[model samples]
Target: ALLDIPCYKILMGCDGKNLQETKDLYNLTDAEQELLESKRRGHALFIIGSKRLHVNFEIPAYKFSYMGKAGGR
Candidate 1:
């Protein structure tokens, strides 16, 4: 499903546990790194190439403080 997008890269960060892997996968943009800041509990996230789209796996409102902090960047 995700492959249909016309992007040069794809990043999947499955919770905080895969931080390094995610960073290695997408080259962690500055804003992206910052988004991972308060995600101590981590989450399943999908970053399509070139900011085309971002999908954070069903996190709760309170836990998504970083999202609000960044104001959807």
Candidate 2:
């Protein structure tokens, strides 16, 4: 989807060769890949063309109320 999709995307744990596997996506410098790795669990990468933008996600300060009845037919 990386090659075909034209909208903004958020990726996590998709550094190094994973970016290369996208084919059209260019190589990230060692420093860039390491930055992605360092932020692993807390951040995501937004790949727009050959540019990889780092974005820190903020979860809303509210919780989901119980939806209840999981798997109810």
Candidate 3:
């Protein structure tokens, strides 16, 4: 059997040797670029889910944050 799943359920992966490459590849916004460039070695993971979106960071200590917008039909 096949289960129907929304595109948001799928996770996309990205990697780079440095923040600049990753920023360029993803075309990050000014704020995002500034955040990534804050540390000497920075990495970030972005995940989108049906109800929310998460941003995981890897720098000095492991950290993560999430945001969701309210909408309805």
Candidate 1 C-alpha error for residue 31, in Å = 2.4
Q: How well does model 1 score by local distance difference test?
A: 0.54
Question: What tens-digit string does per-residue lDDT give for candidate 1 at 24-48?
Answer: 6567766666556545343423544
Name the lDDT value of residue 41 in candidate 1: 40
What value does the lDDT take at residue 12 in candidate 3? 29
**Tens-digit lDDT track for model 2 on 43-73?**
8767776577878777553522343456433
- Give per-residue CA lDDT, model 3, range 1-73, as digits (tens): 1212334332224334665565664565665565555542333334244342335544443232222234321
Clashes of each: 1, 0, 0
Q: Which one is best on lDDT? A: 2
* Error at 31, model 3, angstroms: 0.5
Global Cα lDDT for candidate 2: 0.60
In model 1, where is the ten-residue run with the lowest total lDDT?
A: 40-49
Error of 3 at 34 (Å): 0.7
Local distance difference test scores for all models? 0.54, 0.60, 0.43
Q: Please give the distance, in angstroms, between residue 22's alpha carbon in candidate 3 and its true position after superposition.
A: 0.6
